[model samples]
Target: MTTAFSLAPLFRSSVGFDRFNDLFESAARNDSASGYPPYNVEKLAEDKYRIVIAVAGFQEQELDLQVEKGVLTVAGGKRDNGAQNQEKDNVTYLHQGIAERAFKLSFRLADHIEVRNAGLANGLLTIDLLRQIPEEAKAKRIPINGQQVLEREGS
Candidate 1:
């Protein structure tokens, strides 16, 4: 049994968090569709992250990664191997466990987060992410100018 949560109270106290509320609602609705293609997210450094996904039977050409408007998407599909089609009549599986169906997964990225690189090795797809904060956005000391001005007599 899953317990449902309401975001009504959060909306009352939080300002400018509409996107977060929407994201939470969407996640709750799609919780049932998130089991395939297990993955792990790790923080490598202060602003660096890595996402590793298990893709045992998938090839490099069959996987796709895209980032748009602060959203990252990863998709995979199985291509028809020539041998599998030719030997379909003679092949039989008593128990098939590995999933070959197409799947799409999406992740919401914070501002300034970028996908640095991606690679597939030993059935694991690794995606590197970097959070690059702009120079203006970084914290800096503000110079305070001290000056005194004399007011003129009432005219």
Candidate 2:
């Protein structure tokens, strides 16, 4: 059973969160045909994160990673080549268990989230991410100026 949630309360006190709400809604609505490559998202530090995807048969050249409009996309597939096509035509699998299909995964990132690095090793693709808050965007305390005592006439 799917449950629907109202984000009205979240918007009441928030400003410029329309995109945030849209992200939530889009995530809920999307149902991918296949969960081809399993993945894990782990937090290494307060602002650091890692996403590891199991891409058993995909090579580094076949994988693609991109960040566009606050969304991170990871895609992997076997690229079509003349030699590979000829080799595949000669092979016939009695029981095909391994999946060589293309897949794309997208992650909606909050503001300031930046992809630091990505590496593929041992059939795994690992992506490192960091949330970098700019100097001006960081919180700062303002000093209150000129403290004056006011005396009420009645007092």
Best by TM-score: 1
- Quick one: RMSD of model 1? 6.2
lDDT of 2 by residue, 83-155 (tens): 9889989999999877878898777677888899999999899999888899999999977768756677897
Provide TM-scores for the models: 0.75, 0.73
What lDDT score is found at residue 139 in candidate 1? 91
Worst 10 residues of 2 by lDDT: 8-17
Backbone clashes in model 2, listed as residue pairs = none
For residues 32-63, write the lDDT of model 1, one tens digit per residue. Answer: 54667888777788888888889888889999
> Ten consecutive residues with minimal summed lDDT in candidate 1?
8-17
Q: Which ranges of candidate 1 are over 4 A from the true structure?
A: 1-23, 143-155
Error in Å for residue 6 of model 1:
15
